[model samples]
Target: EAGVAQSPRYKIIEKRQSVAFWCNPISGHATLYWYQQILGQGPKLLIQFQNNGVVDDSQLPKDRFSAERLKGVDSTLKIQPAKLEDSAVYLCASTGTSGVHEQYFGPGTRLTVT
Candidate 1:
């Protein structure tokens, strides 16, 4: 099976600006997730989707960050008025119906806010 696909592997932006990242998960996967990984810490789950419906978003920074899974296939994450603290590698991952233990990740989009 093909791996998850993400766009613009790298991006640099000015603080307070807006940026967006895209992801296309593997076919047949029903669950999708977005995560943020800072320089020294493990990836933090930002949001999760079970087919077009959001399963969890409590960890997401609602004030500046938003995400959606359209048609339960492709997903997008956006940050408006970006902050220096938001600079991190935004990762997209997905898991098959079998379970979360088999999640696959994409080559994350590295965002640098300056």
Candidate 2:
């Protein structure tokens, strides 16, 4: 099976700028997730989607961050008016089904807010 795909492996922006990242998960995977990994810390779950419906987003910074999986396949995450503290790696991951515990992650998009 092919791995999850993400675009623009790196991004650099100034404070209060806007940026977006895209992800294409493995075929047939029903669950998708986004995570933020700050330097020196483990990845933190940002949001999760089951098909086109959001399963969880309690950790997401909704004031400036948003995400969508409109077709249940591809997803996009956007941050508007980004902050310097937002510098981190944004990771996309997917799993086969509700019962599946193993998640395959994409090569994350690294963001640097200057």
Who wins the lDDT comparison?
Answer: 2
- Prediction RMSDs, each to the true structure: 1.0, 0.8
TM-score of each: 0.96, 0.97
Q: Write the per-residue lDDT of candidate 2 for residues 44-106, one digit (tens) a residue.
A: 999999999999999999999999999999999999999999999999999986677999999
lDDT of 1 by residue, 42-82 (tens): 99999999899999999998999999887889999999989
Q: Candidate 2: give the clashing pairs.
A: none
Against the unseen true structure, what C-alpha lDDT does each candidate score?
0.94, 0.97
The alpha-carbon deviation from the true structure for residue 37 of candidate 1, after best TM-score superposition, in angstroms, is 0.2
- Local error of candidate 2 at residue 67 (angstroms): 0.3
Model 2, total clashes = 0
